[model samples]
Target: MASDPWQGHDAAVLFTVLLTGVPTVVGLAVYLGSRLTRQARRRTTPFRTWRDVSLAAAGAALALYLWGLLHVLFLDGQEQAEECERQRPEGTPALVGRRGDFIPLRLVCEASDGRDYTVVIPGYINPSLTVLLLLALLGGVVSLLLHHKQRTSTRKKG
Candidate 1:
């Protein structure tokens, strides 16, 4: 039996995955959004200043990062990694069967402090996303809403 029974919990897995990836993803969005704004300005500005050129370059880099971020967010990752030390299971020098084949998962703690645990990140990964995944997905979709706002503002000013 594995100590970290909660290892396969979907929500935990998804959160861990996204949380790990967010920094890079956000950086890309910023980089791209900045560049995009710059490029738009360049089309209107004949001065062709370094500022516009720089913005365009930045935007390109940002877009590249954004793409990379999305690729990472959608990437396949393991469901869970339960830390054995947290559980403090007893007896084995090294726990058996940390890797390969679906073994039984039992959350056995000893009667006293009982059995601790061994960390297990199952090799098999399920492609299901949890509520966190859904929220992240929703946020991604809702970001499109900003386009309407930008258009509305541009219309009023123009």
Candidate 2:
């Protein structure tokens, strides 16, 4: 048996708050600041194009997904650790397993009131989320470039 894995719960909670809450607050501040600055300038900016809106929406969606992912990876991680601890037998290690990159491996751990756990760590990243994040980034960049080009052409025409 291994030592208690739930000892790091406090640190994980702090890390989760820093990772998720800080960025969300910062993003909101930036957005509100930009809006206030634009309003103060008293410039009647033209409405954004549908494509531009769509790209921004995609970016927002990606950000939301990332927020959820962080929560799941961090907050849920702590919960899982606690659950494992609760199910663990007294005076036994929280984890007991082989330490090697070999097949036919076995891990002895308690989770969710179960006596055993099959921890399968995937070798590859999640392709779907990766693709979606990349697509959001690309769309945002393209939208910026097109908006700049449009502004330049409009200025030239005017």
Candidate 3:
């Protein structure tokens, strides 16, 4: 029987949870807070659209990150080990061990013959998350600049 790679690594699991969970929670909170505020005010500002788009992008990225984390932590290792065992050359013996990666999340299965089979968290996920994060940052900066400009212009007139 294959042992659980994550078993007995309480610190690592806790760290992973905190690293991903905090951002996810913050992103969702910001998104929901803005939505609720907009509903309460019942008026849209010039920068509101940009701000909302930024928050949406952040939320999407965070969701993807969490999904990838879930796959890495709970699903991939054992399945990939089984696949490796099946795919190994005949008479090569069983899978010997497995290893995991956190960033870009993946599992590597080691066979008795010293071959390694890697199962990667879908190719598009990390890159897509990165792009979304960049979009979110750019949109946030644009929104802030526009908001600041609007405030300054009003101040000058007043």
- Separate clash counts for every candidate: 14, 1, 0
Better of 2 and 3 by lDDT: 3
Model 1, 5-117: lDDT tens digits are 33232345445545654665566456546656756656642223333434444434333333333332342323212343344444544422222211222222222333343
* Per-residue alpha-carbon lDDT of candidate 2 for residues 1-158, written as tens digits (9 for 90 to 100): 13644332244544565577557756755654565565644752333333334444454544544443343344344464544455556655445322211122212244333345423223222344456556656656766777788889999999
Q: How does residue 58 of candidate 1 score in lDDT?
A: 41
What is residue 24's positional error in candidate 3, in angstroms? Answer: 4.0
Per-prediction TM-score, please?
A: 0.24, 0.36, 0.62
Specify the poorest-scoring 10-residue window by lDDT in model 2: 98-107
Which sections of candidate 1 miss by over 4 Å?
1-48, 79-158
lDDT at residue 82 of model 3 (Cα atoms): 60
- CA lDDT of every candidate: 0.39, 0.46, 0.69
Q: In model 1, which range of ten residues has the least summed lDDT?
A: 100-109
- Which candidate achieves the best TM-score against the true structure? 3
User: Candidate 2, which segments miss by more than 4 Å at Cα?
Assistant: 1-10, 13-125
Clashing residue pairs, candidate 3? none
